[model samples]
Target: MRDCNIIKDLLPLYKEDLLSNESKTFVEEHLKTCPECENLLNEEIEIESKNTKPLDFVERRIKKETRYFTLAVLALIGSILIFIISYLNTPRHIEYDKDLYKVYRNDKIYTVEFADKVSGIDYTDTEDAIYLDAYSTKYDEIFNKRRLRKSLTFRKENLKTVLYQNHESMPNMVIGSGEIHQTLLPRLFLGFYARLSIIGFIGLTLILFLIEKFRKKAISLPIKTLLIGAPLSLFLGIIAIKGFNTATYYPVTDFKYIVLLSLGIYLFFIFISIFKEQKRM
Candidate 1:
């Protein structure tokens, strides 16, 4: 007589559709001759049917979780967009010539003058020095005076040195006397506007980063940020550096270019991080 116990062990595999064809046939034949084994096989098959309902329920729950996670990522992206728009729209004061003379008299400053525009400070014995030639016709005449000495003076006790400067590279024209002219280079603001521009660019970049974090999609966020941020940052940085030259009254140089290039390199790394994260997903 075929053992009922032996058939019971194979019954579970048979119900799950896991039994080999030969094994299935052998078990079925054994069950037919033994009423006890037949009863056991029928019971095992019923249990398997009951188990499938729970497996289906679990799969449905997992799919719902994934959907909700995606929705949350999208909401985060929306918030980032709102923040960026608001930040860009806000007004930021551009301080051009506050404490103008301090920058003009310091020997450590570098100066540049523009050929087409005359920019200078008028020192009255009473009130603070006034920016006389600003955005005016008087600036044109003052700026075009080629006969005027175009150099900066450095004084060390009884010793003095004059650095020959080119007008093409100068930030703006000035109508100061020999003393003022001598002090101009060292006291001039070298990269004031450029610095401010860099700050603002960084602020914008931060906004981009925040948006990417919220979206969590990682598809093209990093590369996109770099594509958009790099050129934009460079353009704004140049404008800022120029403004610094215009305000502090100087010209662009190798040093300023170096700073801008460095910023670009740093941004490249930030984009790489975003790329890696996206790949991980």
Candidate 2:
């Protein structure tokens, strides 16, 4: 234990206050005669002090950084939540049924029958409104017949009783006639958002997938795949659900849009994962 080599081996532990009493006394006794070993101990102490000071500084910097990062994350989350709420609650401009009726009664009505191939004014609504089948046709000189029937249904109530003479097209297009339907407005809005959400999601996923495949060996992802994926998935999912709720009137279109949107979101996550992995590398 009084050996100089033993004291050198224990120098690091001694500085750390981990030396046994016997080792401590042995090193102290040798240090009395060995100026070289004493100088070595002093040097070790200075190095340890410098190293510990930097570590403390680094630990404080990390703590400060973590605090700021947490605040930023919270603020971002709050903003997104507000945006979503505002979007969901925003009142949409929609044409009501009463407005449609008013427009119908004031506009000119043209009734065309498919079977009789006749356009007549006698196509008035009876006690039970007459249902008209209107179709478009193209004339073929070779066959001496009109071809290509694109038919649409119309209720007699949809017709406007008065006739208006105009040279330009109507300001608004009609679904069945020149009147607008209220039910379609919400559906259209929902369809638009659903399409946007779906596209964004898909783009994100594709990017992630490519990154993952190309940079698999290069880098580690900064965050776990699920950490980023879950949040993004939730965001897109909420958007799709909101769209579906609004588009309830048009279930088929809404459902189709939702499916597309979900797929797109999934792809986006894949891309995100890949990009993160690349960055880490």
Candidate 3:
């Protein structure tokens, strides 16, 4: 056989020290003089290095996030607790009982005081008038001290009128000049947003599917994901806050709770991903 071929056949044995000294010396001598064999030996070494060491790209990524694992878990747990607490504390519309609250005037200003059973209040302000609603959750009505001696003082000057909107529409109580101002239902705006969110969510999902299906240009994953999740979260949150069957008395409050719960769910996924990575390790 050729000297190079002989050296190549002996290379594996030489690397493991299984070759006799005489054979090793001969192969080493060939490697020193023959550039081709020397280059091949170096390439083999490089390949060996790559094969033995840790090569998981995902492992490096996991290391970067390992430090945040504990924080992610806490955030997820806290968010869930907050969501539960918020629901427990949230007040839904209640019937108006004159005994539940008493409205009176003092120093030409007006004040409305609520009993312990009436745990929450929501209101709206219009030109020269105020629309008010009372609410209570089961927990609040039963256990909370929040509404005990709770009083609202209104500046009876430019805003002189106060109306108790016991529920949606008519036969509500007015505490000031009996001038009837048209009261708009809150459900109109909130319900529209809820329905719009659901519709937009569906449309966005369809668009994302179509883009990935036939187009040569790839859709931006992040952009499409946010667009899809944003509306879906809103739709879900609105459904969570108030049922679609009727309008809620508190629109802004409902929106706030919706946003809060979505963030909690996001954190929960982050925690789960971190946990999976740790398990792999």
Clashes of 1: 16
Superposed by TM-score, candidate 2 places the C-alpha of residue 99 at a distance from the truth, in angstroms, of 21
> Residues 1-281, candidate 1, lDDT per residue (tens digit)?
44566677888787777999999898878877888877777776687678755687677766755654554455345435533432332222122342222213445543433222223322212132222222213323444445332223333333223222322333222323343332233324434545555676677767667876899754355555544555455544444334334443223332354344435443544445444544454
Supply the TM-score for candidate 2: 0.34
Candidate with best TM-score:
3
> TM-score order of candidates, best first?
3, 2, 1
lDDT string, candidate 2, 53-136, tens digits: 757767886776566455445544554554444333322222222222222222444332222221111122333223221211
User: Candidate 1: minimum summed lDDT over ten consecutive residues — where?
Assistant: 121-130
lDDT of 3 by residue, 1-281 (tens): 39999888888788778998899899988988999998888888889888889868867776666665666668568768867766786667777665878878877677788777776678787775677777778676666655456678877666656777756456355576565656645566767887888898899899888888888675553345446767776666667777665376677776677667666554555555556655654
Which candidate leads in lDDT?
3
Instruction: Provide the clash count, candidate 3.
Output: 0
User: Each candidate: how many clashes?
Assistant: 16, 12, 0
Alpha-carbon RMSD, candidate 3:
7.5
RMSD of each: 17.3, 17.8, 7.5
